[model samples]
Target: MNGNRFGRLFQVTTYGESHGEAMGVTVSGCPAGLELSEEDIQGDLDRRKPGQSMITTSRGEPDEVTINSGVQDGYTTGTPIGMVIQNKDARSGKYEPYVTAPRPSHGDFTYSAKFGTRNWGGGGRSSARETVNWVAAGAIAKKILATQDIEVKAHVNQIGDIEAPEVTWEEILEHSEENEVRCAHPETAEEMRDRIDEYQKEGDSIGGSIYFEARGVPRGLGAPRFDSFSARLGQAMMSVPAATSFEFGLGKEARQWTGKDRNEDWEFDENGDPTPVGNKHGGIQGGITTGQPIYGEVTLHAPTSIPKKQTTVDWETGEEKEIQVVGRHDPVLPPRGVPVVESMLQLTILDYMLLAGRINPDRLDGQVGEYQTDYHPRSPDNMKE
Candidate 1:
């Protein structure tokens, strides 16, 4: 498709379909010589890969990545980085019945209408399966951001009606991975897991919001008008399949407060640098970073594929019919989408960093002194040069 690419300087063009032989991405504009390997990309793929847990789709694909180009000696070559993952588990037969019927609240009908044809198998190009490319590219972006001390993280904030409490960054890093749902709070994550189990049993699906947080982001990362930081983030997030809602900073809740309550008072940090006492703005002000942690949320709708029978009109027959979407699908999307959200955030922020000139594209061209080996990418220690 013409729109398969994302970003300008650091562009990623994805190809292949859900049921195709493979899906992969070509990431261009990455600077050369930063340490990279298939394993770096595989870690994020493992998180987004399906069939990982009972709550996700049963489609079993290791989502193993092969770096066919753009690297030499475990470092990038600054050319287009090519990577692929085989669609080993696609069952095209399961979707044959819906080829003409189309699924509700999905791209099936729209894609058919637009293209005069569609890949009915696993929703083809429209499937979340396509997101593997984004995650793979994002893994590289994460490595780039790591050099500049930027860290992106995301967690399931809401699952159906279960909402998590506001948590510190430390808490998120500490407890988010402790449970299947990836909610930061242990108790709430358990509740979410139980609820997902309930939905799995009912053959229904659930949806919820994911909170994205980026720490150590440098200021002035976005252009003033068209390339506003939040706007870019919104576009990246909304491009996600089934993403229905987006909120930045205080988000919807900010509407309830007056100017006095919403304003962040200017103060000084330990270094005597001016900073905001509170971050109601969620980091970006006037389309640029405020040197504060960027926080936002994306809300995804329940998956379109479900065991519950749905009534749809067959395009060829022009007759109404009930169809059961029998295929591997997530009962709840937020948990599985956490990595996707984080990946999108990484790509967005990394692109803006490139655009804003906060980082040099040639920073990774050689032996770089900015690299930190001991601290994890998300650690506060990594934030310090």
Candidate 2:
């Protein structure tokens, strides 16, 4: 309950249950005068919504977003931007069986133990549905970042044991959405789709990883140590439901690398600014941005809810029971998670940029290279009477 909010200057607070009335979020600290509308957010929501394809859950929720406040005449008012997405297809009846028995590897048991009682309907706040609010807030951040030419994107790179080859940024932006798997590589996406189909037919689930990147992020946008850029990004990626692992450049593979082999030498850019010769550090060094493309991967565990029978104890009856988690569920997650990962990256980058004073917090004055001086107050002597 207390941990629903995220970010420092640009904060987002979310509310609602998976099977309750609707999911909502209030985004604070956004500058006034930026163009915004429900349509701007609905696109990202549509990607994360259930019932997208054969690999995803069949629930028919539209995930349409409605901006309830903080805008006037198609622009933000710099207040808390309130948005909501109603749960049109939530079926709580299917979850009733696990109310007491709990689902394996699901949050039902832990939530009950922590809160003493829980909504127990579609796992309540523990459901992946809560991310709808995040994607909505992230859309605003994406728009804000876009004003500065910052772009964030992600692709499903690994599904179960199948992995896609390295792809260019243009390929990621182009072909990632062309298939059901959201993988940039077309052939690999087909294989991933078939693998998901196999799992769906078996009533099982599989895990996968998403590769995310942020370009045009300015340097000096992060503090050191606890507030490092990578630290905040790791927290953001790990916060996604079902996310099991997170890694950046070299990441786990760095263990096998020698310091000399892994180190990136620096040189002067054409602008006479220092630049790393290579990006083995993943656009960050000493916990701060390096003016390179920030890239990483987030690995999500398989969805726990499946029709395959699993055993658990019924706390209410104090007896064991066999449960088939019969309900609409995604056999794999990375396809739907592509947008979520991109959103988290956008939110994190925007927050850091705001914190570093790279962007004007009150409003964009519609001028290039005037962010710091446009709205500044004049001296008392210079003020008109």
Relative to the unseen true structure, what is the C-alpha lDDT of residue 310 in candidate 2, on a scale of 0 to 100?
87
Pairing residues by index, what is the TM-score of model 2?
A: 0.95
RMSD from true fold, candidate 1: 5.8
- Residue range with the least summed lDDT across 10 consecutive positions in model 2: 370-379
Pairs that clash in candidate 2: none
- State the local distance difference test value for candidate 2: 0.90
User: Pick by lDDT: which candidate is best?
Assistant: 2
Question: What do the candidate models score in CA lDDT, each in turn?
Answer: 0.88, 0.90
lDDT of 1 by residue, 192-310 (tens): 99998998899998889999899999877886788898888999999998899899898999889999888878988998999888888999999989999999899999887889988
Model 2 stretches with alpha carbons more than 4 Å out: 366-385
Model 1, 212: alpha-carbon shift in Å?
A: 1.0
Q: Which model scores highest in TM-score? A: 2
